[model samples]
Target: MHTEPTAQATATTHPAPTDPACDALDGGPATELCAPRRGRPRSEAAEQAIFAAVEELMEAGRSLSDLSVERIAAAAGVGKATIYRRWPNKEALLVDVVARLEAPAPVRTSTDGSVRDELIAMVEYMRQRGLAKRSRWMLKSALSQMNSWPELREAYQEQVVRPRRAMARAIVRRGVEEGVLRSDLDIELLCEIVIGPILLRTVLWDEAPLEDPGLPEQMVDAVLNGVAAPPPDGRSR
Candidate 1:
């Protein structure tokens, strides 16, 4: 079963100001706080509208370079200032939109101690996500524009890649700790071993509908158990 990656950060009150006046009558500096207090709390309606606008534009064949703050503001029916307040630029907005899209959840370590099974499940989950129609389009869009928009690439790496990699690395580390995998294994390399083939087939080759039901299990087996034939019963090969 797939479980969504939980938010690592929690929203709590910011630390009280160190300024001595903060402890006095009026809370903190009015000049600093009152300015923001005037606006409505960020509207979820506006946020979703903006995300939909970007996706709709992309689906209509507009590249990221073709998008502008004004255009998005018009599309979302919110003021340009609203968009700017949430995302400083189009690249940042697109990164967030893509990040929030429905995709396979990261695979967490299983409690049953079956590392191989967990690895297979993760591979399958990633495969499903990568082969999804919307995901494929998003990947294509990102790849085509990433060369010209370095910040877009950076945002993607920061928001999506790092968290996913962290989850994969953690699971690999757990395998080593449980003696299911070799102690000397490079966690990063192990992660690539599991994800590399799917990426190669789907992204590099544009292979569609990656429908091999056994692919995930086969991949995990190849990584955990060698491809070499086993020795005959009672004798070393």
Candidate 2:
């Protein structure tokens, strides 16, 4: 997603010089002619190596402040240019690294699935994410560091938090439209009702269990059906 500003600006401002060969081939002036690319394509292997290197460094107890692009390049076995080509700065790189480690779960888009089913899927994804060792470590580290690092915090919010929140809100809105969720409730509140418990267990309480496959279903059904018992006369409290 990162681009070299100078190179990009130069390419935009100055088109390639007209080529005589291209003009002959086209039988017209080659004002739109393009030069052949000289740079190699991005290597997936190198990118993976860089991600792995960051994880390895973190696993070795290196703090965020300690991880420089130079160290990452040395560990990844790529030149500094390779890292710069992919990310504008260390904060961007680290944001990507966290995203890779977390691996955002896909939201179900199929129309055949019920609103309840989609809610369960979303909650289950969080449960599975919480169970991941690397993801848990990265989440804890990122949350603790965000307060001190505004750039990293903003990047994480824009790249990670905003997207996830948008997806959750979309799902809740759909449920309201389908009459599965309360129409009067705010979309944000409905989302919190469905997923908040799972998040509490997953992020706030490390000791809380996420191993139960039935947990997501239980949470979703509880929100849908209510936890309160009927009064003796079956009247509203």
Candidate 3:
């Protein structure tokens, strides 16, 4: 008797290789979908070179529009296919670069939940990052093209702006809970108040230097003492 032939095993479809750098880009928390496993081992050297090339171009005052995938690939010493395989297009690549540059190390503050101290540290951090000359040009470029390139704007907000704001809001909420600030405070407005100065200074007065080294202190003081309620006898006034 002839035995029935065994059924052939179905082959699994393997996904193409992805850039491992995407997993730790800026070391921020990324979803699994965003950072897929690499089918092939990643080249650390190539990834570093690509990042350096993008940063170098931005630091040298090159317009984002002037950059192309080919130029970046050439500078990175990798083929166009490599860049394309990682990022679908130039805009996506630029967003990743901006995210990496803008994502600062997490801000640490007093463990006692002191809002004033926390605010001061946060402001100083923002001032340093926002006013840096090299990054300023890149921010300006991103802001200018937001209307035309909505995806770029969304990426910027998602990768750079939103995380910082969420952190700041949490700090404010903690302040309210710890009696450091008034319970009736408008958290969103307070965050905006602290960040407004930095935005104005960076974008509106690009040519001028920030003269006040104690600006962070000034901001914290205004938020804490200035807005704080006066004593029953008005002794605080």
List lDDT for all candidates, in order.
0.63, 0.70, 0.62
Query: Could you tell me how far off, in angstroms, the CA of residue 23 lies in candidate 2 after the best superposition?
Result: 44
Looking at candidate 3, the ten consecutive residues that score lowest on lDDT are 13-22
- The positional error of residue 123 in candidate 3, measured at the CA in angstroms, is 0.7
Ten residues in sequence with the least summed lDDT for candidate 2 = 15-24
For each candidate, give its TM-score against the true structure. Answer: 0.72, 0.76, 0.67
lDDT for each residue of candidate 2 in 1-237, tens digit (9 for 90 to 100)? 232222222222211221112211222222233233244445666777888888899888988778999888888888889877666689878877776666456544454778888788789878887887434676578567777989888877755565566667767787899999999987888888888999899778988988899999999999999999999998998
Candidate scoring better on TM-score of 2 and 3: 2
> lDDT rank, highest first?
2, 1, 3
Write one digit per residue (lDDT tens) for candidate 3, span 70-145.
8888777778876665666787678767655552534444356466777787777666756654356665565676
Specify the poorest-scoring 10-residue window by lDDT in model 1. Answer: 16-25
Candidate 1, residues 1-237: lDDT per residue as tens digits?
211123334423222111111111132323242122233345665666888888888788888888888877777777887776666577767776665553545434335647777677667767776666445676556556877888888766654555555556666777888897887868788777777887777667765557888988888888777777777685655
Model 3 steric clash pairs: none
Error of 1 at 208 (Å): 7.3
